[model samples]
Target: MNHSSDLISGAATAATGTQTTSPEPPPRRRLSRPERERSIVEGAVKFFAEVGFDGDTRELTRRLNVTQSLLFKYFPNKASLVERVYQEVYVGRWNSYWEEIVADRRTSLQERLVRLYTDYAKTALTWDWVRLFMFSGLRGEAINQRYLGFLRSRILEPVAIELRAELGLPGPDRVPLNIQEIELVWGINARIFYFGQRRWIFNVPLESSVEELVQLTIEHFIAGANVLVPRIVQAQIDAAPAHAD
Candidate 1:
């Protein structure tokens, strides 16, 4: 009896069966140029959000399972990549209708503000958005400066103009929006923005719903603005030196 040879043959047969049954991994698909760029930007957004602007591109590529050369092929440099992320996270999410909403005279200023903040929070209060903004600010990146400039011009300045109209104060043409007036609008935005910071960055539990909090904040601002804005403008007027005839 050739028992040893029989055993060797059975082992070989088992190995062959295992190899035949094993599934081969599917081949990687080559993405189109636009598709590749889009993926890199998307991955960078998430990577920067998790680890801030200082996150290494090598680690990012490693996480994405792509070569670093591929990333640079889409983005010339890390700065360009970060810029794309800023556009995607901040500018891309901006609703042009918000400008119209602020300018819409039919809606009361308070309601308009409430709607603006509520909608703004919904769009800008995500984990990626909030964290990336804070990280950029902390790093003194241009992302924060650029976005805040847009906010000041598009939103804060317009809101200040609207508040002047609401309170019967002189328009920007008559009395340019002073820092105090601008800060009043900024305060409202800052409060709403801080809510996002609390929820997303700090990982804190909010005491109330976003809708309730936004409404409450806007209501309080309206109440105070009615009294304070008039007083502030009057104070500014009084502080001005009288011209001698």
Candidate 2:
């Protein structure tokens, strides 16, 4: 009978003599033009979200397991790739229905606002969305500027107009939104936005659920607006220079 030590020595000798090779990985499938571009865009969104606009293309290509030349074939440059990421992440997530929700006067202003913010949180409060936006702002990238302009024009301004209507104040066409009025609206938006910041950036755990907080925020805004907006409009009217009758 072979001893255990003798059997182990024989197995070791056999293993050393026979070189084992790993099985070859399956071949990568060639992507169609659209598929390839889409893959690059999707990968770039995650990459920039992780490392920001300062992240280099070489690293991005490495992360994507694609050649730099292939990346350029689709995007031509890093700026173009960043732009595509902005479009995909920022613009793509925007809902046209948000505009409708803000403009829907059939619903009470408080209800509409709560609904809109609740919907907005679904897209805007995520890790990718919040992180990418903060990174872009830190880098002083144009993404923040562009998106803010869009927000002011589309959402904030419209909400201000609706607030005016709710308070029986003249529409913006009659008396354009004063800076105070705009900033008041912005205050509410800022409060909601900070909830995301505390969550994603500062890594703070919020006790209240997003829905609960949003409803609370909207309620507070409506309560304040009901009191303050009239005074704001009245002050604007008072401050206006009297024209000769």
Q: Candidate 2: which stretches are off by over 4 Å? A: 1-26
Candidate 1 on 1-245: residue-level lDDT in tens?
87999999889989787544668899989989988888888999999999999999999999899998888888879999998998898999999988989999998999999888898888888899989999999999999889999999999999989998988898878666788878888888889888999998888989999999999999998888898888877877788788899
Model 1 residue pairs with clashes: none
RMSD of each: 4.4, 3.6
Candidate 2 residue-wise lDDT, 1-245, digit = tens: 85999999889979889656799999989999999999899888888877888999999999999999988999888888888889998899999999999999998989999999999999998888988999999999899999989988889889989999988899877776888778887887788889889988899988999999999999998898889888888888888899998
Worst 10 residues of 2 by lDDT: 172-181
Runs of candidate 1 with Cα error greater than 4 angstroms are 1-26, 240-245
- How accurate locally is residue 135 in candidate 1, as Cα lDDT from 0 to 100? 94
Can you list the residue pairs that collide in candidate 2?
none
Question: What are the lDDT scores of the predictions, listed in order?
Answer: 0.89, 0.89
**Model 2, CA-based lDDT:** 0.89
